[model samples]
Target: MSSSKNMSGGILACENALQRLLEGKPVLSVHVGLDVSKITASIVSLEAGFDRGYLKKSRRAHLPILAKIESVRAEAGKGSNSSSAKKVQRLEDKVLLLEKELAMVRTQRDRVLTQNLQLWERVRELELAERQNKTRQVRLHH
Candidate 1:
């Protein structure tokens, strides 16, 4: 009885995962506690109303559902691909804008540095002229 309960639980989990996948939700095989092949088999089994014997006897009946599943998966892939491309393009545009801003910042920094150097040079020249004036005054007093 315990084993049966566990089996039912696993089947229930597999069914839920399969339903999510069919609904275009992200459902990995690992999430369902089953490998890829097992998940595929479980999907067919679940679609056949948990009748494995019937599934084996009439595999054709489940083919249409399987095809539909495949198409849904393909469409999802395409949708993700397009969205990913859009994101990449947006990032590239942002990078270009950042690069331009960085260049402008660097140019401003260079200008400020040049101005600071010029101001320092002017201070040194003023100090030198003041010293010369003091020397002349001392000569006149002597």
Candidate 2:
């Protein structure tokens, strides 16, 4: 399934679980092989809570499940923060490498341009010498 659809479904499932907890209902565990579907749903819930500050406001309700959710959220938050920091660092390194490559290319271009100008100057000098030599030959023949 697409990530957005999967995330929305997971959020809905988590909301149902939370409502069941609030009403003191027994939560049914949906087992799919070794994976606990409840945890997947809870993770989505935690992401939304952490991102939107919903869990912070819900803390005033004093529910047992909220405490458990808060602890899990704290752990997840730490892991995510560290992973995101690593990704940012990697991207910065790539940018630095690319910038260095660009500088090298620019330097090479400047050197080639200078060489081209020098070659053109030599061609002009050769043409002028040829013209002078032809004039001297014509004078000798006369």
Candidate 3:
């Protein structure tokens, strides 16, 4: 009957709702109609870009908790064989993409290194030729 007891109950309900949201469950509450899809969109928008807009700035405090939720999801996948297989496939695809990028970068680095060495060799040869010409000129003068 007391106001303090009612306030405590309200706080407990909010905490339960948050836990359900973090677990990727649909929260069906009459007072708060929180859609799971809307929350997912909000989280994705906050993390998808380089710019920190108003939504991102306001949601910045939730990033750590969301990251923990992701870890929990990954752990949960292990319990389901099909979900674990899907997760593995996604990870493998990412690894393949990174490997391709790494190979391209290595090829570019090799090309640049070869060009640098060739330029240095040409400079050395030119310097040798210049020294030889100076020597001949000095002998002729003498």
Which RMSD values do the candidates have, in order?
A: 8.5, 12.0, 13.1
**Worst 10-residue stretch by lDDT in candidate 3?**
48-57
Off by over 4 Å in 2: 1-78
lDDT by residue for model 3 over 8-39, one digit each (tens)?
45434434544666554534432144433334
| Pairs of colliding residues, candidate 2 | none
- As for lDDT, the candidate ahead, 2 or 3, is 2
TM for every model, in the order presented, reads 0.51, 0.45, 0.48
Per lDDT, what order, best first?
A: 1, 2, 3
Whole-model lDDT, candidate 3?
0.57
Residue 99 local lDDT, model 3: 100
Ranked candidates (TM-score, high to low):
1, 3, 2
Q: Which pairs clash in model 3?
A: none
Per-residue C-alpha lDDT of model 1 across residues 1-142, encoded as one tens digit per residue? 9966765654555455457645545344433433232335445455434543322325444455555546655666667777789889999999999999999999999999999999999999999999999999999999
Give model 3's TM-score versus the native structure.
0.48
Across 5-67, the per-residue lDDT of candidate 2 in tens digits comes to 765554455566555543435234322221121333344344334333333335433244456
